[model samples]
Target chain A: MDFFHVLVVLLESTIRVSVPLVFAALAGLFTERAGVFDIGLEGKMLGAAFAAGAAAAVTQSVWIGLIAAILISVALSLVHGYASITQRGNQIVSGVAINFIVAGSTVILGEAWFRQGGRTPALAEGARFQTISFPDADMIREVPLLGPIYADLLSGHFLLTYLAFAMVPISWWILYRTRFGLRLRAVGENPGAVDTAGISVIWLRYRAVICCGILCGFAGAYLSLAMTAGFVKGMTAGKGYIALAALIFAKWRPKNVMFACLLFGFLDALAIRLQGTPLPLIGQVPVQFMQALPYILTVILLAGFIGKAIPPKAGGVPYVKER
Target chain B: MSTPYAKLPGWVEYGLIPLINLAVAFLVAGLVVLLVGENPLEAAYHLINGAFGRGEYIGFTLYYATTFIFTGLAVAVAFHAGLFNIGGEGQAYVGGIGVALACLWLDQTMPWYVVFPLAILGSVFFGALWAFLPGWLQAKRGSHIVITTIMFNFIASSLMVYLLTRVLKPLGSMAPQTRTFAEGGQLPKLDWLLSIFGLDVGTAPFNISFLLALVAAFGVWALIWRTRLGYEMRTMGHSPSAARYAGIRESRITVITMMISGGLAGMMALNPIMGEQFRMQLDFVQGAGFVGIAVALMGRSHPGGIIPAAILFGVLYQGGAEIAFEMPSISRDMIVIIQGLVILFAGALENMFRPAIARAFAMRGQRAAAVVQTRGA
Candidate 1:
């Protein structure tokens, strides 16, 4: 295959892989920007993924399941926020508990509902997200080097993939150019300033967390409805944590978050491609190498070794009224 | 107003917090059982009695308790250093695999005493190595311990599954498990001692590993409160800046703390090995490392406090497994529902003072006198 054609396969796979992480990272960005520690994003994603898959399988409608997923995940988020924000509970414990709760509960619920023990009933065609194809694929394919990649990679993705990409700009707009953005960033960096400015800090944060829930809803849907079309126990895997890393890597900026997600997605794409492939002198690729790639990059990024990526100063610390 | 509540000692202040936390967890567990349509009080009773009830039950629990003790202390040690180490699940598994390999391959001909300790040491080496990666990342690379540790858990689980199924499958059988430990590799039962006590201990599933656990706990306590390295850890936990200024090498302490923590978790793998079982099956450590997180939390990150917390969990685990027999469809997973809720409630301080905090917040910070009880990390 030509370089352009090779690039196309890379691009297409990258986008599909990046979508869930993008939604998750954006979700993380909102929560962190509102000053709530959200190590629970993994749990939220898992809960949402299970709900979306199960609902879609039952209703045979992806859209309904998507909505249900958002609601269910937001409920978990409420639990996390209520603990960390309201009660000033330890963020890490609450997060781990949520993850554990979702993990064990999902399996128990699945066992009760489907007799499958650890998985939901697989969804039929109407319940799964359909891949979209360009109307003028032939024309687009002939345009240029970039065009070929775009035709192959950008085409035939789920609608949510497009929306996930669109979210980068949307998140940037909502977090930078709007009133909520001002309060959101202020609350994260300086909650006292926002509080003194007459804005309700808690309410403003509550909205951001809600928005995060909705975005994560899409990620969960993308995983089950589009990525695999079924729910497997612990299937969201550690993608949510990767998304949190992406958020940190991007310095909590939406556009930058896109770059980080794509980088991780590329590694994921490469990993998949390398699976079962024999290296020239090195022999079969050790799967562990690929598995550790994203985490390796995360450590590098978080170390500020890849330039300075400072978190919002007050990111995980709860704010209270100070005299 | 003139009560000791106005001036409790530091250790008691922190120590009693976990006890209260356990009570809070029990209350929440009761509520969860209610949701499951069972009698909360009755279930709680069964939970406690089942754990310590019959000689058989205590036999089972004692067999299981060592792992929770090790893993709980593992997490608590890291917690003392202000690091939320969720890598226990992975570390314990890695350690178990190491113990299995050492007995199954290398130390098969060694004397029982040498082979047993050697297997445990093998576990520590691997567990420490596994934890070393995340610890290094957190210390040198600025990665959040929570995130890195979590990612390692996935990597560990998948890698273990693949290895067990592929590289390490038993030769004769296609089972994804190691052959039993060789004769000399297994620990000898303390049957004489059990009979001498007249406790009527059956087959002696309980081993000297329990004594090792108690020793490790007190050992950890002394390390943290009475030693130089521990002083650095506590200082760093309270304030990294002060620790650094006080001539403690913060980065080195981070790595060393993780190594010790992971080594402790490695001891969890030792339970199955040195026990009557004498070999670890896949995830034989099971989710003990994860549940140990709750134990570490409810124990309020104290070495000694983790014992009762782990005992409570062991009872619930043993009892919850029995529920599958009576209500076949309900299955053993219902215990998870209770466990998850206990972790949540035990870790949630707001739940402890819910009514008071609710009233205080309702008044819009009016009743918030001083408000200085920041949550533990």
Candidate 2:
């Protein structure tokens, strides 16, 4: 393929791989920014993915499934919020429990309800996300040096992919510009201060967690309905954890988190491409290595770089009402 | 029923705590099964029976408990140092591989006297290696053990999967395990003891691993309670700054504790390789390291406490599998639900028990009031 074709493939694939991560990372941002450590993103995404796929298959419209998935995920996130925020339970354990709950529950429910063990019924084409066709600006292709790169790197994706990129700026603007953002950050950094200021720390955390839930919902929707158009077992496949790492690697900055997600996505894309290419000694180079590529990069990026990323001081501490 | 439980004595509270934990554990398992439309009570009944009903099943449970002791102890020691060593999974695998390698390399030429010690030591050596990196990172760079250990798990898993498929692939076969250990490398099984109990020996794979696990637990208890190093580890766990202020090298302790934890857990692999797998085979360490976290947590990270906790875990494991077949109603995932519950209740022990104890004392007052009223009537 020509350079232009390669660029286009890279562009589309990057969106396909990174959208879920971007959404998840952004979800993580809302929680972390509000001072709630959300290791439950993996569980939230898995739960949402199953719910969305099952809903889509039954409803025959991915849109309705997406909405229901968001509602369900938000509800589940509330469980985490209640346990951590109200009960003042251990956030890490609660998060771990949520993950376990979703992982085990999804498969059990799937097997019984659909009679398909660990998977949902496949979606109809109508239930699947369709690509949006944009008119080729061939004139741009004929223009100066930057034209081909632009065409190759910027066209043809599901609407959500475009929205994934859009959410970062939206998150950034909301976090830095709005009243809600200020309250959220304040609650995270100092619940006592937020409380003394007459704002309910509980409400602020709940709001942040709910926002996180919606993004995670969309991330799950993207994996099952948008990217592949089916729900396989564990299809989210630790993307939520990567998103958590991305959030940390970005050090609570939305744009940087987006960049981190894209970097991991790039390595993922690179590994997938290398699969078809011939290499010496180890023929085909076991797909397991490629499958593990993003996680390995996540590990390195997190261990190496996140050493410098500072979390909100009160991040994992549950806020309790004490006079 | 008016809060069913009221105030209680301190010892009663302590004894009833495990009961509450057991109840909660089954409830969690049952609830999960119920979600799939299975009867919770029936599922649990089968699970309970399956885990402890037979000599063979009990043997399997003991077999599991033996390894769990290692991983549990590994996690417990690290917990003492305030380290979350998720790398137990990785360390155990490497250690298992070490045993496999030693057995494979020395199987034909070496006698049992030399080969067995070398193989076990080899496992410990690799286990330490597995933990060293994360320990080093935490000590030197102040990296969170939780995150770094998680990273190592992924790396170890990837490496192991590759080894099974490529480098460690068995001869003349596509089987995912190494060739069987030589007779010299195998641990001696006490089949005669099972026959004494009127049980078929082969049914219960239980062997000498239990003794070693017991010795290790006592060793851990002594290490934690009796020694200056133990005091330092506890101090470090409670307050790293305080330990440092006391002239203790906090970083060195962190590394040493993790190394010891990982090495002991590595020793647990000897049970399966020398006793059961015979072949250093595929993915045998199924979540033992992770489950070790549950065991340690439930045991409250106490050495004596861990044995009972490990046995409880083993019973549930064996029982959960039996439930899968015998009951056919309970889903096999009952084990995870039970595990999750054990962790939950163990974590909540103080809060749960404190209230119950206070309420019990209040009940005594109510009984006295009732007697006075009856006498007046």
What DockQ do you compute for every candidate structure?
0.36, 0.38
Q: After superposition, how far is residue B275 of candidate 2 from its true place, in Å?
A: 2.6
Per-residue C-alpha lDDT of model 1 across residues B80-126, encoded as one tens digit per residue: 78888989999998887777877877556777777767777888899
Superposed on the true chain A, the predicted chain A of model 1 yields a TM-score of 0.94
Model number with the top DockQ: 2
Weakest 10 consecutive residues of candidate 1 chain A by summed lDDT: A145-154
RMSD (CA, angstroms), candidate 1: 6.0
Determine which window of 10 residues in candidate 1 chain B has minimal summed lDDT: B1-10
**For model 2, how does the per-residue alpha-carbon lDDT over B192-224 read when each residue is reduced to its tens digit?**
666688865555668776787888899999999
A1-323 per-residue lDDT for model 1 (tens digits)? 47557667877788888999999999999988888878878888888889998899888899998998999888888888787777767777788788877877777666666778677778888898898888887688888775676667768788999999998898899889998898899899999999899998888878877887888888988888999978898898788888987887788888889999999889889888788989789899777677777776766667677886777878777667665
Q: Runs in model 1 with CA error above 4 Å?
A: A2-10, A136-152, B1-53, B97-106, B136-141, B155-179, B189-205, B241-249, B276-282, B350-377
In model 1, what lDDT does residue A292 have?
74
